[model samples]
Target: MTLRVLGIDFGTTYSSMATLDPVSGRATVLRNAEGEEKTPSLVYFGADGTLVGTPAQNIMLEDEEEAAWVFMAPKRYLGDGDFVRALPDGRVVTAVDAVAAILTKLREDAEALHFGGPVGPVVLTCPASFGPSARDALREAAARAGLGDVRLVEEPVAAGHAGLRDQGQRLGNVVLVYDLGGGTFDAAVLRRVEDGYRVVVAPRGLDRCGGEDFDRSVYRWFDGAAREEHGRSFDASDGSFNSPVLRACRMAKEALSSKPKVTLRGVLAGQRHKQDLDQATLEGLIDERIAATVRLSKDLADAADRRGHAIEHVLLIGGSSRIPLVTRQIVEALTEPRGLPEPLRLGATDFAVAMGAVYALVALDDMAPSAGSPWRVRAPGTVFRDVDAPWCPEMVVLPRGRFQMGSPEDEPGRSNDEGPRHWVEIGYDLAIGTCAVSFAEWDAYAPRGSERYHPFDHGWGRDDRPVINVSYEDVQHYLDWVNDRLGLTGREDRYRLPSEAEWEYACRGGRETPFWWGGSITRRQANYSGDYTNAVKWLGEYFKRTVAVRNFVPNPFGLYQTHGNVLEWCEDTWHKDYIGVLTDGSALVKKSSPIRILRGGSWNDDSRNLRSASRNWFPSATRLSWIGFRVARTLIS
Candidate 1:
């Protein structure tokens, strides 16, 4: 009966729901009332009552005239306020009302089958083509469905999240998503940053082209042949969707994927018609549509290339992407120049977007358990080491609190990007390394025997000294190694670099002064050069070489060398200022950038650079002799 989060993919033709599996750290799709992974996004209104899912689909096929009451593809008109219809009971239905009905069914099914009550946070997925109005409509629909404050994610971006979670690869790769659903086609390019992927190129897709169009073509071919045999033209019923002819045509299209030919039998315009459609003929009918998708994918590839990122993998998602012809076209069009591998075809194409939405939910809303649950809560200054890897850096638990991030304009040596100071709330307890990661810890992961990059160490000796000459990218490999050793590889709770906000908050240690000790810093307090002084009281001393991380006195938070020693890499992309940065203490990693934030100060920097609010940045791949990093652990309660 524990509260759980849900991710719902609201597709034009079908809908799916998923949640994070705490045990495996993977997304698990939830089955609907009929025990199916996917539910048809159809609603039928009749004199008896309202019907959804399979029953509604059955009713639609039973009577084509019911197309007036049966609603399908409501997703296509999400933001169209003018789109309104009336039901048999004399009730007016708008696009929002129809979408709400579908979402309500999904939520109820999940609660009944899994949670036994209302779930926790919900993440709803929509097409990338959705504008601000469409996004607002989706939120309004969820609200009407009784779902509280839900998060919104683009369908293709959610699919990208799922792809990365399933693969469990380290970050820094470019990927493309080709999504062909029942009523639309979307192609998006993404770059895998930190814990998620960012859209490299805005998504491009056709609003009115998808599997339904193919179904219409099959209906036309059969209707034309039937008219010729009967020697007469008959009355025309509803043009498409909910019509028995279109339903039969859709069934034939699916069967043709695996079968050499499929028989389509139906009464078109009151005339009984039956025909066998071969795969080749069906391919010819939808060739132009598939060609359109291929052209869109090529454009994305070229855009990524122009941005200096080569798409490493292409993921095919949504129902229509299952067609063999779609894959053949994508492979031929995208395999040149770099010999890109064949586009990946997921087995659960219908559920990829939903599952990916779950992964994104975990990334954005993940939190540790409360104190005294499965995870133990310890007081501040409590230092511990992982039992599995005793050589891991020692971590000290830090208390949670709110603090003003960034500096005031009046502060000495304040940078323009540091102003516009904002309040950041560190809501959960965290454990940060007592000092910067040492050379000994780095060597334990990539030893002399391994082929990993070995820093020069500036001939300053290795062991207990802080690790230097390391790039931001190199630090990620070490963290991955540590997580693997502790068996927390892809879980919500793992070792990672502290976010910039967390770094500044920890450095302050509940002090409002420029330095944690006071407004002035002395040579005896930290490991920075004293030749230049922010305040003249303590000046005229300098250490040209790096010192051991723990050689200095600990701050009020029991953290050592937080003010100096080595510049620590923080987990955030560099921005001009804190104008629109995250206020929740989480990393601001919306997009991938070559530059990343760096905190603290190095051995050769003046005292001004060692202040708690001082900030700096460097390219992620740039290795500097003064740059190193500390680790932080998410304490799951």
Candidate 2:
């Protein structure tokens, strides 16, 4: 019998649960009595000890004093040991207890759906940046909720598993998982093994950052506008205009996400405050916060290298990941000299994590051993095989051939990057890795030797996945190490990036279709966009980070996961007009500018940006989770 497991994502703004349904071979999200897929991670205690959610939010409007027991963002204080003190009644309640009450209610709802039977073991998901103490707090809360046998999984990992299950694909290595929640932001690097997943590194984020900050920026904008119009700022000190004003501000922010501008009309301080807020204005307000996120992501990627690993792809998850400005900033900060996959190819922001959770539940059950510790799994075989010593002359070879390089002129759902079709031929053959180089490969060549090969905390992924989070200088150094070990001169032109033409040529596989497989994109064809056709589809499965390199189908060139695993780097400097300048098959590597090219759409990307012709470029020194590279060698003819 399959032991059912409950998966919970205890988000700061909202919480959701899913359980494996044996009858369906699928995971079902447990809905509340109101038929909601998630419950607000909010708790309210009345003077009479009554608890509520939607009701509490509503009651807080009429009786602010009585609503003193209401706690909206208690999850944010989980490990801080903070407590909410109820006013008037002066009752002290621990954050853990408050969270427990919310979980207890969810447990009741799950029990009701299960016909009063125990739901079995529980799998709880937390932020990747969470430490042991934060995880312990969540476990304690689950225990109070009457759940036994709890196991902890990182939020991004759960989402990545969910994404893989949704597409019916296995997970991959060097996967980047970006989780931006209501109150916090986290990004992680993960690798997929034959049996399960392992975290390569856990990067921290601004605990006080996220969608709420964006909302506040919007609110502050409106407040500034109100002051300019009425000659007086709206009073939030008394809290009279707080709730309605905040609601209006939130709606406006959501509207600006899709629409260019939003209009807000309301009465504040007895004066009608009406204003039209455009995307530019809102983005300007939150630009600093967005830039901060990008910086944090890059710093984390750089830190990953200290541990001796590279980042290949970046997965964007959580509701806040949808902001256009946020996406653009991350792309700009992470884009490198090597060509990278297009940046914005993933799914809608709101559902990625929830969808990923469902996929994770199913995958865990499928991999669980018959008996013993439900948490651990036995490895099928050694993931590594001895390769030639580092600095050895191993080459990545691209065949001299012609392939359809762009989508057809009339292709449906096509984007600007996929157009202006043209083709060329590579007159020479090249040698490349039979598979992406792994951490083990790098360890074999580390200058300090094997004694220094002990696992580094920041370097992520297993030996089988493509190594990621490496810099242009780092890649060059690795190549140098390889050459030195093999007793070869570290010549400049001997090892280099494949030309942009080579990257697209390989990705297209002689086809003119939008994707390597030719037909319209579906989740099964690649590891991008949340599943749109399956139940896991409805649950939202695109990971917020990277996956293993072999998690999905490879292009016809015998390349693995060319489309949506991690963005591979190429040798050319970035030029918007490089396509016009390409008369030969080689990259324009001698440009005066210092930037580099990145190729291949990553797991976080949407389908549109994953097309064969999409282009992305960044400074050579910039490093990010989604940016990783593969090598190409000129064949000795």
Highest lDDT: give the candidate number: 1
Query: In each prediction, how many residue pairs overlap at the backbone (N, C-alpha, C within less than 3 A)?
Result: 1, 55
Candidate 2: tens digits of C-alpha lDDT, residues 1-637: 3565667777887788877667876666778766877687777766777564566667776654545667776777777764554555777777787789888877788788753777666667777555434656878988998987666665666665654444333223455566777878876655565555544444345676777767777777787888887877654554434656666777888788799988987676676889998999988888887787777777667644543446655677787777788777777778452244434324534545654554554453433535554442111110111121232322323445765554565765454554456667776554444345555566566633454323331444555555666777777877765554332344433545677887777777667666678655666566675433111343335656656655564555545566765677788787655346564567877668878877767766776666666677778876666666766655331
* Span of ten consecutive residues with least summed lDDT in model 1: 366-375
TM-score of each: 0.58, 0.55
Query: Residue 49 of candidate 2: its Cα lDDT?
Result: 73
Least accurate 10 contiguous residues by lDDT in model 2: 377-386
Which stretches in model 2 have alpha-carbon errors above 4 Å?
Answer: 62-67, 167-173, 231-241, 300-312, 335-338, 344-351, 358-637
lDDT of 1 by residue, 410-495 (tens): 88778798879899998887888878998988887777768987787878899989889899899998888888766568866688
lDDT of each: 0.79, 0.62
Model 2 RMSD in Å is: 20.4
